[model samples]
Target: MSFAERYGPWAVIAGASEGTGREFARQIAAQGLNCILIARREGPLKELAEQIRAESGVECVTASVDLAKPDAAEQIAAVAGDREVGLYVNNAGADPNGKRFLDNDLQNWVDLAQRNVMTTLKTAYLFAGPMRARGRGGVLLVNSGACYGGSSFMATYSASKAFDLCFAEGLWAELRNHGVDVLSLVLGQTDTPAYRTLLAEKGLPLPTNWASPVEVAKVGLAQLPHGPVYNWGQTNDVAGYAPNSPDQRRARVLMIEQHSRSTFGDD
Candidate 1:
Protein backbone atom coordinates (compact mmCIF):
# COMPACT_ATOMS: atom_id res chain seq x y z
CA MET A 1 0.00 0.00 0.00
CA SER A 2 1.08 3.59 -0.55
CA PHE A 3 2.29 5.55 2.46
CA ALA A 4 -0.72 7.83 2.38
CA GLU A 5 -3.11 4.88 2.20
CA ARG A 6 -1.38 2.98 4.99
CA TYR A 7 -1.01 5.90 7.34
CA GLY A 8 -3.60 8.50 6.30
CA PRO A 9 -4.10 11.21 3.74
CA TRP A 10 -2.47 13.97 5.79
CA ALA A 11 0.69 14.46 7.85
CA VAL A 12 1.58 17.26 10.26
CA ILE A 13 5.23 18.24 10.50
CA ALA A 14 6.09 20.55 13.38
CA GLY A 15 9.15 22.80 12.95
CA ALA A 16 8.73 22.57 9.21
CA SER A 17 10.11 26.02 8.36
CA GLU A 18 13.64 24.85 7.71
CA GLY A 19 16.33 22.21 8.07
CA THR A 20 15.34 18.58 8.67
CA GLY A 21 11.74 19.59 9.23
CA ARG A 22 11.55 21.12 5.76
CA GLU A 23 12.99 17.98 4.26
CA PHE A 24 10.35 15.93 6.08
CA ALA A 25 7.59 18.14 4.70
CA ARG A 26 8.88 17.76 1.16
CA GLN A 27 9.38 14.03 1.41
CA ILE A 28 5.99 13.36 2.96
CA ALA A 29 4.34 15.51 0.32
CA ALA A 30 6.16 13.53 -2.34
CA GLN A 31 4.62 10.44 -0.79
CA GLY A 32 1.15 11.89 -1.54
CA LEU A 33 0.26 13.00 1.95
CA ASN A 34 -1.04 16.51 2.31
CA CYS A 35 1.09 18.46 4.75
CA ILE A 36 0.36 20.88 7.56
CA LEU A 37 3.60 22.75 8.34
CA ILE A 38 3.98 24.39 11.73
CA ALA A 39 6.71 26.76 12.85
CA ARG A 40 7.30 30.11 14.58
CA ARG A 41 8.52 31.80 11.39
CA GLU A 42 5.67 32.62 9.06
CA GLY A 43 7.73 33.70 6.03
CA PRO A 44 9.73 30.53 5.84
CA LEU A 45 6.69 28.38 6.49
CA LYS A 46 4.72 30.05 3.69
CA GLU A 47 7.67 29.76 1.31
CA LEU A 48 8.04 26.07 2.14
CA ALA A 49 4.32 25.54 1.69
CA GLU A 50 4.47 27.20 -1.70
CA GLN A 51 7.45 25.09 -2.74
CA ILE A 52 5.74 21.88 -1.64
CA ARG A 53 2.54 22.75 -3.45
CA ALA A 54 4.43 23.69 -6.60
CA GLU A 55 6.67 20.65 -6.67
CA SER A 56 4.50 17.84 -5.36
CA GLY A 57 1.08 19.33 -6.10
CA VAL A 58 0.08 18.37 -2.57
CA GLU A 59 -2.09 20.57 -0.41
CA CYS A 60 -0.15 22.44 2.25
CA VAL A 61 -1.23 24.46 5.25
CA THR A 62 1.14 26.64 7.22
CA ALA A 63 0.70 27.39 10.92
CA SER A 64 2.79 30.21 12.37
CA VAL A 65 2.96 29.77 16.15
CA ASP A 66 5.60 29.39 18.81
CA LEU A 67 5.65 25.77 19.93
CA ALA A 68 7.00 26.99 23.26
CA LYS A 69 3.55 28.39 23.97
CA PRO A 70 1.35 26.08 26.04
CA ASP A 71 -1.49 26.01 23.54
CA ALA A 72 0.60 25.30 20.45
CA ALA A 73 -0.77 21.79 20.07
CA GLU A 74 -4.37 22.98 20.06
CA GLN A 75 -3.57 25.69 17.53
CA ILE A 76 -1.91 23.14 15.25
CA ALA A 77 -4.93 20.83 15.60
CA ALA A 78 -7.24 23.65 14.70
CA VAL A 79 -5.28 24.31 11.52
CA ALA A 80 -5.42 20.63 10.68
CA GLY A 81 -9.22 20.87 10.86
CA ASP A 82 -10.95 17.51 10.13
CA ARG A 83 -8.13 15.94 8.10
CA GLU A 84 -7.12 12.44 9.06
CA VAL A 85 -3.60 13.26 10.23
CA GLY A 86 -1.84 9.91 10.04
CA LEU A 87 1.73 10.95 10.56
CA TYR A 88 3.00 13.54 13.03
CA VAL A 89 6.69 14.51 13.00
CA ASN A 90 7.48 16.21 16.28
CA ASN A 91 10.67 17.90 15.09
CA ALA A 92 10.38 21.21 16.92
CA GLY A 93 12.90 21.51 19.76
CA ALA A 94 14.65 24.13 21.86
CA ASP A 95 18.30 24.89 21.28
CA PRO A 96 20.08 25.64 24.52
CA ASN A 97 22.90 28.13 24.79
CA GLY A 98 26.11 26.12 25.18
CA LYS A 99 26.87 27.44 28.64
CA ARG A 100 27.17 26.03 32.11
CA PHE A 101 23.83 25.31 33.81
CA LEU A 102 24.31 28.15 36.27
CA ASP A 103 25.19 30.62 33.55
CA ASN A 104 21.70 30.59 32.13
CA ASP A 105 18.89 32.43 33.92
CA LEU A 106 16.05 30.40 35.46
CA GLN A 107 13.55 31.60 32.89
CA ASN A 108 15.75 30.41 30.04
CA TRP A 109 15.73 26.93 31.50
CA VAL A 110 11.97 27.08 32.02
CA ASP A 111 11.38 28.19 28.43
CA LEU A 112 13.62 25.43 27.11
CA ALA A 113 11.78 22.86 29.20
CA GLN A 114 8.44 24.10 27.94
CA ARG A 115 9.55 24.01 24.33
CA ASN A 116 11.38 20.69 24.43
CA VAL A 117 9.29 18.69 26.90
CA MET A 118 5.88 20.21 27.46
CA THR A 119 5.14 21.04 23.84
CA THR A 120 6.21 17.60 22.66
CA LEU A 121 4.07 15.95 25.31
CA LYS A 122 1.07 18.07 24.39
CA THR A 123 1.51 17.40 20.67
CA ALA A 124 1.72 13.68 21.21
CA TYR A 125 -1.27 13.67 23.51
CA LEU A 126 -3.40 15.64 21.07
CA PHE A 127 -2.36 13.88 17.86
CA ALA A 128 -1.94 10.32 19.10
CA GLY A 129 -5.53 10.09 20.22
CA PRO A 130 -6.91 10.61 16.74
CA MET A 131 -4.27 8.30 15.26
CA ARG A 132 -5.23 5.56 17.69
CA ALA A 133 -8.90 5.99 16.93
CA ARG A 134 -8.15 5.65 13.23
CA GLY A 135 -6.31 2.34 13.87
CA ARG A 136 -3.21 3.23 11.79
CA GLY A 137 -0.75 6.11 12.12
CA GLY A 138 2.80 7.07 12.96
CA VAL A 139 4.63 9.49 15.27
CA LEU A 140 8.27 10.45 14.94
CA LEU A 141 9.93 12.15 17.88
CA VAL A 142 13.21 13.84 16.93
CA ASN A 143 15.80 13.39 19.67
CA SER A 144 19.54 13.88 20.01
CA GLY A 145 22.56 11.79 21.01
CA ALA A 146 22.83 14.09 24.04
CA CYS A 147 20.08 11.89 25.40
CA TYR A 148 22.58 9.14 26.18
CA GLY A 149 23.82 10.72 29.42
CA GLY A 150 24.28 13.97 31.28
CA SER A 151 25.88 16.66 29.18
CA SER A 152 27.82 19.20 31.21
CA PHE A 153 27.00 22.43 29.34
CA MET A 154 23.76 20.98 27.99
CA ALA A 155 22.26 19.50 31.12
CA THR A 156 18.68 20.62 30.72
CA TYR A 157 18.71 20.15 26.96
CA SER A 158 19.92 16.58 27.33
CA ALA A 159 17.37 15.91 30.03
CA SER A 160 14.55 17.05 27.78
CA LYS A 161 15.81 14.84 24.95
CA ALA A 162 16.00 11.94 27.37
CA PHE A 163 12.35 12.54 28.12
CA ASP A 164 11.59 12.40 24.40
CA LEU A 165 13.58 9.20 23.98
CA CYS A 166 11.81 7.45 26.85
CA PHE A 167 8.42 8.82 25.91
CA ALA A 168 8.69 7.59 22.32
CA GLU A 169 9.94 4.15 23.38
CA GLY A 170 7.14 3.67 25.89
CA LEU A 171 4.57 4.90 23.39
CA TRP A 172 5.95 2.53 20.75
CA ALA A 173 5.27 -0.42 23.03
CA GLU A 174 1.82 0.79 24.02
CA LEU A 175 0.71 1.82 20.54
CA ARG A 176 2.07 -1.11 18.55
CA ASN A 177 -0.93 -3.22 19.40
CA HIS A 178 -3.12 -0.37 18.26
CA GLY A 179 -1.34 -0.12 14.88
CA VAL A 180 0.29 3.23 15.66
CA ASP A 181 3.98 3.26 14.87
CA VAL A 182 6.06 5.42 17.23
CA LEU A 183 9.71 6.14 16.54
CA SER A 184 12.41 7.88 18.55
CA LEU A 185 14.67 9.48 15.94
CA VAL A 186 18.08 9.77 17.57
CA LEU A 187 20.14 12.21 15.53
CA GLY A 188 23.84 12.92 15.53
CA GLN A 189 25.36 16.16 14.20
CA THR A 190 23.34 17.22 11.19
CA ASP A 191 24.29 19.91 8.66
CA THR A 192 21.33 22.17 9.29
CA PRO A 193 21.31 25.96 9.17
CA ALA A 194 20.91 26.27 12.93
CA TYR A 195 23.79 23.87 13.53
CA ARG A 196 25.96 25.77 11.07
CA THR A 197 25.20 29.03 12.86
CA LEU A 198 26.16 27.44 16.16
CA LEU A 199 29.45 26.24 14.74
CA ALA A 200 30.19 29.67 13.31
CA GLU A 201 29.38 31.32 16.61
CA LYS A 202 31.64 28.95 18.47
CA GLY A 203 34.43 29.35 15.85
CA LEU A 204 34.55 25.57 15.47
CA PRO A 205 34.87 23.51 12.35
CA LEU A 206 32.02 21.37 11.11
CA PRO A 207 32.14 17.76 12.20
CA THR A 208 33.08 15.35 9.42
CA ASN A 209 30.26 13.01 10.40
CA TRP A 210 27.54 15.60 9.89
CA ALA A 211 24.57 14.17 8.01
CA SER A 212 22.48 16.21 5.63
CA PRO A 213 18.95 17.04 6.66
CA VAL A 214 17.64 15.42 3.47
CA GLU A 215 19.50 12.20 4.17
CA VAL A 216 18.32 12.14 7.77
CA ALA A 217 14.72 12.73 6.78
CA LYS A 218 14.83 10.04 4.10
CA VAL A 219 16.36 7.44 6.39
CA GLY A 220 14.06 8.37 9.28
CA LEU A 221 10.87 8.07 7.25
CA ALA A 222 11.89 4.85 5.52
CA GLN A 223 12.75 3.25 8.83
CA LEU A 224 9.45 3.98 10.56
CA PRO A 225 8.42 0.32 10.44
CA HIS A 226 11.68 -0.68 12.14
CA GLY A 227 11.27 1.56 15.17
CA PRO A 228 11.02 2.13 18.68
CA VAL A 229 14.35 3.86 18.09
CA TYR A 230 16.40 4.73 14.99
CA ASN A 231 19.76 6.43 15.31
CA TRP A 232 20.73 8.60 12.37
CA GLY A 233 24.28 8.15 10.97
CA GLN A 234 25.15 5.75 13.82
CA THR A 235 27.73 8.33 14.89
CA ASN A 236 27.33 7.35 18.54
CA ASP A 237 27.04 3.83 19.89
CA VAL A 238 24.39 4.79 22.41
CA ALA A 239 23.01 1.27 22.72
CA GLY A 240 26.43 -0.27 23.38
CA TYR A 241 27.53 2.18 26.07
CA ALA A 242 27.23 0.90 29.61
CA PRO A 243 26.17 4.04 31.40
CA ASN A 244 25.74 2.28 34.72
CA SER A 245 29.40 1.18 34.93
CA PRO A 246 31.39 3.48 37.19
CA ASP A 247 34.49 3.58 35.01
CA GLN A 248 32.53 4.16 31.82
CA ARG A 249 30.41 6.87 33.44
CA ARG A 250 33.51 8.67 34.66
CA ALA A 251 35.15 8.39 31.25
CA ARG A 252 32.01 9.70 29.55
CA VAL A 253 31.92 12.72 31.85
CA LEU A 254 35.59 13.45 31.25
CA MET A 255 35.10 13.17 27.52
CA ILE A 256 32.10 15.50 27.60
CA GLU A 257 33.98 18.06 29.72
CA GLN A 258 37.06 18.00 27.49
CA HIS A 259 35.00 18.28 24.34
CA SER A 260 32.89 21.06 25.74
CA ARG A 261 35.93 23.08 26.70
CA SER A 262 37.61 22.55 23.36
CA THR A 263 34.52 23.25 21.26
CA PHE A 264 32.70 25.99 23.07
CA GLY A 265 35.39 27.35 25.40
CA ASP A 266 33.22 26.30 28.29
CA ASP A 267 35.09 25.38 31.45
Candidate 2:
Protein backbone atom coordinates (compact mmCIF):
# COMPACT_ATOMS: atom_id res chain seq x y z
CA MET A 1 0.00 0.00 0.00
CA SER A 2 1.05 3.58 -0.59
CA PHE A 3 1.63 6.20 2.06
CA ALA A 4 -1.90 7.49 1.78
CA GLU A 5 -3.42 4.03 1.53
CA ARG A 6 -1.68 2.84 4.66
CA TYR A 7 -2.11 6.01 6.68
CA GLY A 8 -4.58 8.23 4.98
CA PRO A 9 -8.11 9.43 4.45
CA TRP A 10 -7.45 11.81 7.36
CA ALA A 11 -4.62 13.07 9.53
CA VAL A 12 -4.59 15.36 12.56
CA ILE A 13 -1.87 17.81 13.54
CA ALA A 14 -1.84 19.19 17.08
CA GLY A 15 0.26 22.31 16.47
CA ALA A 16 -0.70 23.21 12.97
CA SER A 17 -0.70 27.00 13.19
CA GLU A 18 2.89 27.61 12.21
CA GLY A 19 6.44 26.37 11.75
CA THR A 20 7.13 22.63 11.81
CA GLY A 21 3.59 21.67 12.71
CA ARG A 22 2.23 23.70 9.84
CA GLU A 23 4.72 22.06 7.54
CA PHE A 24 3.68 18.62 8.70
CA ALA A 25 0.03 19.39 7.96
CA ARG A 26 0.91 20.59 4.49
CA GLN A 27 3.00 17.54 3.77
CA ILE A 28 0.36 15.15 5.04
CA ALA A 29 -2.26 16.86 2.89
CA ALA A 30 0.03 16.79 -0.11
CA GLN A 31 0.22 13.05 0.27
CA GLY A 32 -3.60 12.81 -0.29
CA LEU A 33 -4.77 12.88 3.34
CA ASN A 34 -7.45 15.25 4.50
CA CYS A 35 -6.21 17.29 7.46
CA ILE A 36 -7.56 18.32 10.83
CA LEU A 37 -5.46 21.29 11.99
CA ILE A 38 -5.43 22.19 15.68
CA ALA A 39 -3.78 25.21 17.29
CA ARG A 40 -4.37 27.90 19.87
CA ARG A 41 -4.50 30.63 17.23
CA GLU A 42 -7.72 30.38 15.31
CA GLY A 43 -6.93 32.81 12.53
CA PRO A 44 -3.67 31.23 11.47
CA LEU A 45 -5.07 27.77 11.93
CA LYS A 46 -8.03 28.53 9.67
CA GLU A 47 -5.78 30.19 7.13
CA LEU A 48 -3.54 27.18 7.07
CA ALA A 49 -6.49 24.88 6.65
CA GLU A 50 -7.73 26.89 3.68
CA GLN A 51 -4.25 26.92 2.20
CA ILE A 52 -3.98 23.18 2.51
CA ARG A 53 -7.36 22.71 0.89
CA ALA A 54 -6.36 24.99 -1.98
CA GLU A 55 -2.91 23.57 -2.52
CA SER A 56 -3.55 19.90 -1.92
CA GLY A 57 -7.21 19.69 -2.92
CA VAL A 58 -7.98 17.88 0.32
CA GLU A 59 -10.53 18.65 3.01
CA CYS A 60 -9.09 20.62 5.95
CA VAL A 61 -10.69 20.90 9.36
CA THR A 62 -9.53 23.60 11.75
CA ALA A 63 -9.79 23.55 15.54
CA SER A 64 -8.56 26.34 17.78
CA VAL A 65 -7.53 24.68 21.01
CA ASP A 66 -5.10 25.35 23.82
CA LEU A 67 -3.44 21.99 24.25
CA ALA A 68 -2.56 22.86 27.85
CA LYS A 69 -6.20 22.85 28.83
CA PRO A 70 -7.55 19.68 30.45
CA ASP A 71 -10.12 19.14 27.73
CA ALA A 72 -7.79 19.82 24.82
CA ALA A 73 -7.62 16.22 23.67
CA GLU A 74 -11.38 15.90 23.80
CA GLN A 75 -11.75 19.13 21.86
CA ILE A 76 -9.51 17.76 19.14
CA ALA A 77 -11.45 14.52 19.04
CA ALA A 78 -14.65 16.45 18.63
CA VAL A 79 -13.24 18.39 15.70
CA ALA A 80 -12.06 15.12 14.15
CA GLY A 81 -15.59 13.68 14.55
CA ASP A 82 -15.79 10.03 13.49
CA ARG A 83 -13.28 10.30 10.66
CA GLU A 84 -10.52 7.73 10.88
CA VAL A 85 -7.44 9.65 11.95
CA GLY A 86 -4.71 7.65 10.28
CA LEU A 87 -1.90 9.99 11.30
CA TYR A 88 -1.48 12.01 14.49
CA VAL A 89 1.31 14.60 14.77
CA ASN A 90 1.82 15.72 18.35
CA ASN A 91 3.70 18.97 17.83
CA ALA A 92 1.99 21.21 20.39
CA GLY A 93 4.73 21.42 23.01
CA ALA A 94 7.23 24.24 22.71
CA ASP A 95 8.53 26.48 25.49
CA PRO A 96 8.77 29.93 23.95
CA ASN A 97 9.71 31.49 27.27
CA GLY A 98 13.09 29.98 28.09
CA LYS A 99 13.22 30.93 31.75
CA ARG A 100 14.89 29.19 34.66
CA PHE A 101 12.64 26.73 36.49
CA LEU A 102 11.83 28.95 39.45
CA ASP A 103 11.79 32.14 37.42
CA ASN A 104 8.73 31.04 35.55
CA ASP A 105 5.26 30.90 37.05
CA LEU A 106 4.28 27.58 38.62
CA GLN A 107 1.07 27.53 36.64
CA ASN A 108 3.09 27.86 33.46
CA TRP A 109 4.92 24.67 34.32
CA VAL A 110 1.67 22.91 35.13
CA ASP A 111 0.14 23.96 31.84
CA LEU A 112 3.25 22.86 30.00
CA ALA A 113 3.11 19.48 31.67
CA GLN A 114 -0.54 19.16 30.82
CA ARG A 115 0.10 20.03 27.21
CA ASN A 116 3.19 17.94 26.64
CA VAL A 117 2.64 14.90 28.81
CA MET A 118 -0.98 14.43 29.69
CA THR A 119 -2.49 15.47 26.37
CA THR A 120 0.05 13.42 24.47
CA LEU A 121 -0.83 10.28 26.36
CA LYS A 122 -4.56 10.90 25.95
CA THR A 123 -4.44 11.57 22.22
CA ALA A 124 -2.07 8.71 21.50
CA TYR A 125 -4.27 6.34 23.43
CA LEU A 126 -7.31 7.65 21.58
CA PHE A 127 -5.90 7.33 18.06
CA ALA A 128 -3.44 4.48 18.41
CA GLY A 129 -6.19 2.07 19.45
CA PRO A 130 -8.06 2.42 16.18
CA MET A 131 -4.81 2.41 14.22
CA ARG A 132 -3.73 -0.79 15.89
CA ALA A 133 -7.05 -2.43 15.11
CA ARG A 134 -6.83 -1.30 11.48
CA GLY A 135 -3.21 -2.52 11.28
CA ARG A 136 -1.74 0.73 9.88
CA GLY A 137 -1.12 4.34 10.86
CA GLY A 138 1.49 6.66 12.42
CA VAL A 139 2.15 8.73 15.52
CA LEU A 140 4.77 11.41 15.05
CA LEU A 141 5.87 13.19 18.20
CA VAL A 142 7.94 16.27 17.53
CA ASN A 143 10.57 16.46 20.25
CA SER A 144 13.76 18.39 20.89
CA GLY A 145 17.50 17.94 21.55
CA ALA A 146 16.84 19.34 25.03
CA CYS A 147 15.29 15.95 25.80
CA TYR A 148 18.74 14.34 25.84
CA GLY A 149 19.65 15.97 29.18
CA GLY A 150 18.88 18.65 31.69
CA SER A 151 19.41 22.32 30.94
CA SER A 152 19.96 25.30 33.22
CA PHE A 153 16.85 27.00 31.87
CA MET A 154 13.90 25.22 30.28
CA ALA A 155 13.77 22.59 32.99
CA THR A 156 10.09 21.75 32.48
CA TYR A 157 10.43 21.85 28.74
CA SER A 158 13.39 19.50 28.70
CA ALA A 159 11.78 17.10 31.10
CA SER A 160 8.57 17.05 29.10
CA LYS A 161 10.45 16.37 25.88
CA ALA A 162 12.36 13.54 27.52
CA PHE A 163 9.06 12.01 28.50
CA ASP A 164 7.81 12.40 24.93
CA LEU A 165 10.93 10.73 23.53
CA CYS A 166 10.64 7.75 25.83
CA PHE A 167 6.90 7.54 25.25
CA ALA A 168 7.25 7.53 21.49
CA GLU A 169 10.00 4.94 21.55
CA GLY A 170 8.03 2.61 23.78
CA LEU A 171 4.96 3.07 21.62
CA TRP A 172 7.03 2.36 18.54
CA ALA A 173 8.21 -0.94 19.94
CA GLU A 174 4.73 -1.94 21.04
CA LEU A 175 2.95 -0.97 17.82
CA ARG A 176 5.54 -1.85 15.18
CA ASN A 177 4.31 -5.43 15.09
CA HIS A 178 0.75 -4.13 14.78
CA GLY A 179 1.62 -2.00 11.71
CA VAL A 180 1.50 1.33 13.55
CA ASP A 181 4.59 3.48 13.17
CA VAL A 182 5.55 5.77 16.04
CA LEU A 183 8.46 8.20 15.67
CA SER A 184 10.02 10.69 18.03
CA LEU A 185 11.29 13.35 15.64
CA VAL A 186 14.03 14.95 17.70
CA LEU A 187 15.06 18.36 16.40
CA GLY A 188 17.89 20.78 17.25
CA GLN A 189 17.41 24.55 16.97
CA THR A 190 14.93 24.71 14.19
CA ASP A 191 14.18 28.02 12.43
CA THR A 192 10.59 28.52 13.51
CA PRO A 193 8.41 31.53 14.20
CA ALA A 194 8.21 30.65 17.85
CA TYR A 195 11.99 30.26 18.11
CA ARG A 196 12.50 33.59 16.40
CA THR A 197 9.96 35.26 18.64
CA LEU A 198 11.61 33.84 21.73
CA LEU A 199 15.04 35.05 20.60
CA ALA A 200 13.65 38.44 19.70
CA GLU A 201 12.03 38.75 23.11
CA LYS A 202 15.37 37.94 24.74
CA GLY A 203 17.13 40.44 22.45
CA LEU A 204 19.37 37.70 21.09
CA PRO A 205 20.54 37.06 17.57
CA LEU A 206 19.41 34.14 15.46
CA PRO A 207 21.57 31.03 15.57
CA THR A 208 23.96 30.58 12.68
CA ASN A 209 22.95 26.94 12.42
CA TRP A 210 19.29 25.99 12.62
CA ALA A 211 17.17 23.34 10.94
CA SER A 212 14.43 24.23 8.46
CA PRO A 213 10.85 23.40 9.36
CA VAL A 214 10.26 22.17 5.82
CA GLU A 215 13.20 19.82 5.86
CA VAL A 216 12.43 18.69 9.37
CA ALA A 217 8.87 17.76 8.38
CA LYS A 218 10.06 16.00 5.26
CA VAL A 219 12.66 13.99 7.16
CA GLY A 220 10.11 13.17 9.83
CA LEU A 221 7.59 11.80 7.31
CA ALA A 222 10.24 9.80 5.47
CA GLN A 223 11.64 8.38 8.70
CA LEU A 224 8.29 7.54 10.32
CA PRO A 225 8.28 3.93 9.16
CA HIS A 226 11.88 3.51 10.39
CA GLY A 227 11.02 4.77 13.89
CA PRO A 228 11.48 4.84 17.34
CA VAL A 229 13.45 8.03 16.79
CA TYR A 230 15.11 10.27 14.25
CA ASN A 231 17.51 12.98 15.45
CA TRP A 232 17.30 15.73 12.88
CA GLY A 233 20.50 17.44 11.68
CA GLN A 234 22.50 15.47 14.26
CA THR A 235 23.77 18.89 15.30
CA ASN A 236 23.90 20.33 18.83
CA ASP A 237 26.55 17.86 19.91
CA VAL A 238 26.57 19.55 23.28
CA ALA A 239 22.95 18.62 24.02
CA GLY A 240 23.85 14.98 23.06
CA TYR A 241 22.18 14.87 19.69
CA ALA A 242 25.18 13.51 17.81
CA PRO A 243 25.55 10.47 20.03
CA ASN A 244 21.96 9.34 19.37
CA SER A 245 22.57 6.77 16.67
CA PRO A 246 19.49 5.00 15.29
CA ASP A 247 21.02 1.58 15.81
CA GLN A 248 21.87 2.35 19.43
CA ARG A 249 18.38 3.66 20.18
CA ARG A 250 16.72 0.68 18.53
CA ALA A 251 18.96 -1.74 20.42
CA ARG A 252 18.16 0.00 23.69
CA VAL A 253 14.43 -0.30 23.05
CA LEU A 254 14.81 -4.00 22.27
CA MET A 255 16.95 -4.50 25.36
CA ILE A 256 14.40 -2.90 27.63
CA GLU A 257 11.59 -4.85 25.98
CA GLN A 258 13.45 -8.10 26.59
CA HIS A 259 14.03 -7.18 30.23
CA SER A 260 10.38 -6.31 30.73
CA ARG A 261 9.15 -9.48 29.05
CA SER A 262 11.48 -11.64 31.15
CA THR A 263 10.48 -9.89 34.38
CA PHE A 264 6.72 -9.93 33.68
CA GLY A 265 6.63 -13.32 31.90
CA ASP A 266 5.20 -11.52 28.80
CA ASP A 267 1.69 -11.80 30.26
- The candidate that wins on TM-score is 2
Summing lDDT over every window of 10 consecutive residues in candidate 1, give the lowest-scoring window: 241-250
Give the poorly placed runs of model 2, Cα more than 4 Å off: 235-243, 265-267
Per-residue lDDT of model 2, residues 40-79, tens digit only: 9999988898899889999998888999999999998888
Top of the candidates by lDDT: 2
lDDT of 2: 0.90
Instruction: Report the error of model 1 at residue 92, Å.
Output: 1.2
Please give each candidate's TM-score. Answer: 0.87, 0.95
- C-alpha lDDT values of all predictions: 0.83, 0.90
Q: Which pairs of residues collide in candidate 1?
A: none
